[model samples]
Target: MTDTQPRTGAPAKPQGFAATERIESPQGGGPGRGPMVGGMVAQKAMTFGPSAKRMVRRMRPEAAPALLVVALSVISVVLMSIGPRLLGHATDLVFRGFLGRRLADIPSDQLPDAAKAQGVVPGVGVDFTAVGHWLALTLAVYVVAAFFGWLAGYVLNGVVQRTVQRMRQEVEEKIHRLPLGYFDRSPRGEVLSRVTNDIDNVSQTLQQTMSQLLTSIMTVFAVLAMMFWISPLLAVIALISVPLSLVVTRTIMKRSQGQFVAQWRRTGQLNAHIEESFSGHALVKVFGRQGEVEDVFAEHNQGLYGVSFKAQFISGLIMPTMMFIGNLNYVVVAVVGGLRVASGQLSVGDVQAFVQYTRQFNQPLTTVASMSNLLQSGVASAERVFELLDAEEEPVTGLDVPQRDGGGEVAFEHVAFSYDPDRPLITDLSLIARPGQTVAIVGPTGAGKTTLVNLVMRFYDLDGGRITLDGVDIATLSREALRSRIGMVLQDTWLFGGTIRDNIAYGRPGATDEEVRAAARATFVDRFVHSLPDGYDTIVDEEGSNLSAGERQLLTIARAFLTDPALLILDEATSSVDTRTELLVQQAMAALRADRTSFVIAHRLSTIRDADLILVMESGAIVEQGTHDELLRADGAYARLYRSQFAAVEAA
Candidate 1:
């Protein structure tokens, strides 16, 4: 089949995630609200409220399994904590036995039977055998707990990695579905960092911080319970420090949150600058602006470094402060318990157990303080990602239009458009092309020729008026249904990093190898393909950099031809080709245009001389429209454009 034969079925429209826009409220409101109170609440709430909730909601669906794994790991921590307290109890027993012997000062015959039988003082009750049994049991529990802890960690890591993978995939899919305008508005490096660096931060939190946080919490709870069981008075004294530690942690986090956000923003800026510089390195070299660019980069890099240093400096204070508080609690427990034991209010064993419990209680607090930094960083990264995911999508509301059936008859009626509504790009533009007719759009730069075609394809909605395909409004049709009947080839071709066959098949995924080869031959792409070492299997590097401009354009033409759409658009198709290549491409285009409606945008005036109708546009309006011969006879805008091109050709 020829390139003009329309393929069956429709191409799927890109899918985008749903996002809602809403103004968030401050922390609180009351009947007696004041301006100062409201301002403080708003500031505080903005930092820790809606943004955080949004991030968690975006991440939680995928992170559910990981969260479960974390909970399981927490359970293992609790079991392990039990072992530590048991070890403390065993230690207390040994200390008690030694203390009893020293305090009794009695001969072995005077000790109780049980103590005497074990070769101890007669009236003094100290069981060494019993202590040894308890020690062995504690050791066994420790071994078992350690084994489970390792297992939990191993499983949790796998779960977290998988969760991260899903999140990355979802983000990638969402980006693909989003309108091209979104990318135009956002910096490339900033978007990329959200997917890469930000996701990596979340992954770190999942794999490391999450586990540590769980373990720390479990340890604290278990240790606190054991401390209370041993001695309520000592437990109360140790617990007094908990409130103080919490206050300190809260203060540090509150101060550090804004700094962390600033740090992330600076990092994104630095990444953006680096990416922009590297991507345009050739331009920098050509313009002799390498030194200027380097200076710019250094400024951004320094900004990032400063922000990061400040954030880390603040976050790093938490762990040391926590440790200091923990040590103070330790001192209080020691001094109080020692006084109690001297007064005969507590046994040596009881005092030793309480000390161990105090140490255990502090362990989780220290861990939680250390992990706070990572958790906050992850939260910041997640917020960035959700910001993108929460961006508005293109409108796709109308659904009353009829589907096209491969007969391309496009008409624009008083179409107007503007990338920004305040500045109109096209105004009151009208054009039409009948089925099986070829139309050439000739215009000066910024005359809205490309915008006209973009309207027909519904890339951007018209600000006013309507576009219709086969007598049906394009807006009423599904985007996929409308675009399925059209094929486009542009001067700047983009080929993915894959084999030539793969690239060609991308236009029609299910196209047979025979059909692919036929399309290539029709476009004269086979000649170049055969010359390559691997023919159809040859790999094209990034953006088809391995091929010449003309060659890349031909490959794109081949792809468009392979799709076999009823309507073909050649937007500056011959702009990049040499004279010889242009002639070849023009001939191939003519063949592809047969029995189909085609819109040609040509700088080379000769290629479109045979078009059924020619529209000469200037300032978003068609200044002249007629057959090529009639326009030439009229000596209007089309004639001037033709003459200018002819003069340039002769000069060349």
Candidate 2:
């Protein structure tokens, strides 16, 4: 209700769009229908390394919490790594006690030569107390490790989620600051995907991968240290698998990274397609293009499937490949350990611990390799979000200029503009509207009728020249100040989900109930509201689809009425209403326009017949300007347009 005008300042028609004229630019231009997926394409293309680094920086704000997570992960892995060594000791004590109990039954001298050479103690009965102690310690180690692991993941989740929340806020603010021309070229659905689907994907990918990745990496290092502690030679043998795992994982990631980027990019395109197709579903049925739409959907869906399968399949190679290398390394270490044990160079318990360490070392390598998919997918999404965040913002200028009291006198001093620089839409055009005058603009479809009004509203900054209201340049005034004095009703109605009274109240927040009804009565809306079940309380759907076109237009007009602006604009204001209601709206508008400057852009000659002044335009310049009767007497472009329009009606 507070900000009815679009921040982009895209023009609402002279009539139907009451307040939301600024916003409809992107939504108005259906997302691009390129032969390929360009609508949702990233503004800037990026690769895994840079995008990943940027994502890391985004989390820098949560460094303290992130460090806490790392500390926990380190503690967890180190504690867990100690357990296998303890278990190896327990195994040694049990073996020794078993041998001692058996040997004690015989005399020491009568014991086997091997037992004597090994220095086995006699009369030891299993040493249950010692074994029980070792077992309890190992249990404690594992339980603590598990606790730390859980805490690490919990803290990491909050850090990543908070970062994502900030990213969303940045995107929202950026959307408000982006220029209208950006949307004119970009697809609406594509913009929406970046904000909604892309950001969500990024959040999911980061939360799922970050903590697990930390733990896996830490486990590798911790287990390596323990392995080397047991025996340098065996540790070196196990170390061979590290480089081999890296080689395999790196190769697979390089191949899968491109596919992951394509997968998310295709996802954006698919979303854009779905959004556009469904938004205009009625038109599709009316034109009988359902088969065509289905074919396109199938094309997009198939592309996504193929890319997704490749990304997953390629990243999927890491786990099994790493495992194969790990198992091979395990075999080499086992053989070496057995030979050393046979030579009495290593103790039975030490060899046992070394074997367990090998597995612990290889396990984390495998885990990190397996997680490449989520990491790549997340970085791919991060790049898309970054592209949006980096888009050029509208320049903040004209703040040094001053303001003046409103008299509703707008002047164009040699204004020049174009949708594209080479293709001018308006050039060196100048006109003046005195206070209390009704200025009607009539032109062919591409005659710059809407452009003239948009310039006055400062929707687009001028390439040259200046426009002023009450002798104060509009560019100097903030968009907020300029728009506050102007009210508009464009050709297409914009109504959000709200009660009838609320929609009107959007024009003026905190409006009294009586004030709302008074505006409704002026626009002839009150006549129909009471017939509905809730009268003024009746709720309208988001698009106001439940209401007839005329009723929707009337609500918008009533909204403009409540604003009571110093300047008014109506673009085909009565285009939707029946002739009977058109008269009522016209009367209401006249009362509203009294003592205020009003601009009307219309094609209907009868509508502007009584205007104080009329301007005729062709291409990018005005060809004539005068009263309607004066133009009729002159028999120029305006006269011909008028004669043709009425002639067509007579022929019908």
Candidate 3:
């Protein structure tokens, strides 16, 4: 996504930057700029690169520890590889010694006539003491090598686990620092997949794939070196398989990488669909669209399966191809080594060692080919993760304009806004709420009542004009500082999964237990809370499903009360509650609104009859405004709305 600069209080035009650049200066450079750059430059660096480059950047400076571990692991693998060859040599030596002993056991008279003619006896043999001493030396070498090999594997595994742990922690921190708008545009499941699934894939790649790859590479080199020491001619023939196997591996990797990318994308899509379905299960059931949702989910599931199958199928071919090449190399080495021994150019021991080296070389190749699939999957996952880390954050820039403390006066001057620029939701809207006054905004759905509030809160910057709090332009103040003085209760109460006391205290985190209960009593929520099984200590389920809608609304109002904010916003807060509960909520609201600036967006005209000023809004603009009696005398839009509500009440 392209990056746009944060708008300034002055009328100067703002400048834009490339998404990859760190916004060091505000749109228009001035005083009161933020301490750090607007967005993370390091995250952007990782966004566009190969998997290896991205992985290296993601590891950060902490990778130094992991690198040291990896180096030690490589050394261990080398020692282990050498150890196996040493053991094989010792086995051959033992066999040869046994052969000599067997010949010595034969009687001198049992010698063949050809042996007698040549003055050679079957019973004659080399010194057993010398042969035993040589065998002991080979066994010692074998034992030492095996010990080092085990040590290497153990050390490397620890390093791999620790490195992955650090990486996961860093990724989670980045996710939290990203802006709210980023979450708005992206699917929850897709974001969650990166944090959960992508990190998991990378961990597996480190723990299993990288370890196997390192061991295989070291073993292959060690075996090839031993083969060259034994028989240079056989080594030369064995080296041919190297390029052949590499070609096969490169082809498989190239084909598998694209499939892996597609597979991960499909997996994310499937996860997003599943999360959407579950979150909206109630709506789906109410609409009788469960079958339709099932069909859509099945389609996504099948798509994921198909892509995963193709990715795995291509990667799965690498192992068999390497094995085929390995078998061919083995036969060639054996035949050539046999011929050389027959020509008396090589000893039987040398031929035996050469054949063993050839097998060892093939074994590592098979291992590396097997690990290619995991490597590809990890690379794909890293690409997705980096994409998120690289996303642009919201702009934060402006001077600190001092606001009047607890004044609670809000004024909009010719303000305009649009969810999309081409379609304005509010046009040239202007209004004012005096200190300690209750302003009620009345309108049909999509009449921009909420949009007006959003602009007032600076949730979205105005396309035109300005919004000021206590005569100070809001755009010039810090968003966090300004929002702190305002308390909002939305129609849909979002109570996090926590104890009732904790949710109430969310409005003022440091509030005492007595203070929390006082706030609850002011909102008339204490009665219901105390009646619960665990009273105020009861744990609410997700979205506070354990409580009725009216109780949830009361809890939200109680939370707002605890904050004791100068400006309180109740946006259709009592719309869903029953009549009796609504009356209780109104009584609580009356108590909470004492000496406070309040804005109530009410559908029921009765709730707003006592408001100091009632604004009649139509199509984003204020059509009429006056006190209840003044508006009723004027017989304007407010009068019509009041009469309509009065008629409805009388009819009921």
Candidate 4:
């Protein structure tokens, strides 16, 4: 059968992601892989409940410490709440003493009839001793309350900081398990935002808002209980304002929730644009698109500003509205309680205490209403993080077949695949590479040359077909086992932040200094590396900007050389270097491929002229296959490709 089967139906596009090649920034901390574009599109606000439960579940390891934080917070709020009531009692004592002194000034027969009828003793003196005792008790309560508050803060900081540290670690680990396709479709900025920004939001909430939330909620209930204990009549009046505050708070939250969601999403977009701009600053200036870039940033920034202002302005109204209701309650309490006091049914001190309680009751309500926005923003951040943690991971559950030894054999039988299945890019294509053979893959852009390499590496699974290595179906082998036998060097070279020696030893970690140096020598990296002052000890920054592009390519070659895999795939491996370096790299490749199976995807047709097998592909189907001489003799697609490149080089 031919490589391609006849079309049956149109291809279906994949959902939730676009088909795009992944781009890695040479600058460190550039846009990361995430779902947002330019990091600025307004995402739908996620529900808070599930995300909250997930975080609580994840933080279970710190349960004991978290519980301790809650206990301390509760004790602190209780202690603080009691301080006001005790001070109120002291006020009552002082007021009583003043009245006693006044009564003492009058003779028993001359005393007011109401006082006499109420059985007030004549010639009574002010009780300074009792007043002093009340003052001391109030001071002690306040001091103890302050101490509890300090202690709670100390314990809570430890718990929150530690929990956030663990959360960051888990998120880092989760990124490694995700599939390559996820990165292919998502922007790097959005991913970076989640790892750094979103996590920080959750961290800040834990540190500043968690204990405060508990304390504010508890304070509300405690103040209400004290109000009831003092006088039920005034307490009932105070209660009327609670429902009013609730209605105001609910209205503000409903309006502000959508704004908060939009605010965070726009923030992410602004970040994405900034990252993209910085990384491609040279390109922006070359194209004279700086103004356009600035305009886009302004648009995103303005969007964020509008939403954030609205959310804050709306949520901001809660405190004042609650305070106004509180003051209104206080006035009513004062007026009615004064009448009761004049009738000797209530003391002036009791009225003062009830007013304080009413104020205290409003304080927590205001804090909680304010906290609602912060909590929502925090939960929104948490949803992004949880979304990443919950992304579909690349599965690794196949049988653990042993890695093939020596030169490897590869075969693709009726391979069918596509980035978006409905738009089939490759169909029933098949090819084979015998042991110790060099297979050269050539095709126009989007003709599935890289896709073929991707399939062979199992970076993606096939829709229909089995690929075999050493006569064993690869599906039966664990991904680790299968990939362990192969080595690759791509056009984009990546190096981590470390000493040169460390990076060269990355592929075969724990490789000796001698072995690393030997591999570097093989790839000709030693020529430039040894000339440097630090030699192999030089530090490469996060982006590897310390080295030139060609230098980075040399290091990656050294890394792959150290692996000594049975199979090697090189996609435009020597495209970065000058002609002189290209010759050196070709020589190195020739020596490396002497007894190993290799696949070379080359745009420079001349480079693969010596390859044992040349597969000239067009639109995902192999149209011609033969050695260089045979292909020129056939005068087909391969010959035309060769003639075109030969003419271009001659003209240059």
lDDT of the candidates, in the order given: 0.72, 0.81, 0.71, 0.78
lDDT of 3 by residue, 1-652 (tens): 1112222222211111101111122243311122111211122222223776767565455455556655655665555545545554554455444544556766768854433333333444445565566567656655665565556567666666666777777678777556544654456677788878987887888778666776678777777778777778889999999899999998888888788887877777777677777877887898888898889788888988888998999999999999999899889988988777556576555667677778778888888888888888887888777777667655575555545686688888887765545444466667778888999988654455665666666666678888878788888887777778788888877789889999999999899999999998888888887778999999998778899988998898889999888788888888768898888888878877877778888778888889998887765667778888999999888888888878977999
Residue pairs whose backbone atoms clash in candidate 1: 110-122, 110-123, 111-121, 111-122, 111-123, 112-122, 112-123
The RMSD of every model to the true structure, in order and in angstroms, is 9.6, 5.3, 8.7, 4.2
Per-residue CA lDDT of model 4 for 1-652, tens digit only, reads 2566433432322221212222232222223332223423224557666766776676677788778867777777777777777776677666655666667767778866545433456556556687788778878877887777777788778878888898899899888778775654446676788889999999987777877777888888888888888889888998898888889988887778777767777777778788878877878888888888889889988999998999888878877887788788878988988887777776666777777787788777778877887877888788777777777898875787676575788898988887655556677887889888999988665455777777777777888988888888887788788888888888878899999999999989789999999999999999999788899999998679989999999999899899998889888888788889989989998999888899998888878989999998776678889898999999999889888888978999
Query: TM-score, each model?
Result: 0.86, 0.91, 0.83, 0.91
> Which of candidates 1 and 3 is the stronger one according to TM-score?
1
* Cα error of candidate 3 at position 483, Å: 2.2
lDDT of 2 by residue, 1-652 (tens): 0111112333222221122222122334322232222353334558788888899899999999999998999899989999989998887788777788887878878876555534457887577788899999999999999999999988998998999999999999998888776665566677887899889988998888788778778888888888888899999888887887888888999999999888988888788788878878888898888998899899999999999999999999898898899899989998999888766676677888888888888877887788789889888888888888888877876664335666699888888776655455555767889999999999776566777777777777888789989898888888777888889998888899989999999998899999999999999999999899988889999889879999999999999999998889998888999999898889889999998899999988898898999998776577888999999999999999999999988999
Off by more than 4 A, model 3: 1-49, 98-171, 398-404, 632-652
lDDT of 1: 0.72
The window of 10 residues in a row where model 1 has the poorest summed lDDT is 14-23
Model 1: residues >4 Å from true position, as ranges? 1-46, 49-75, 100-128, 398-404, 643-652
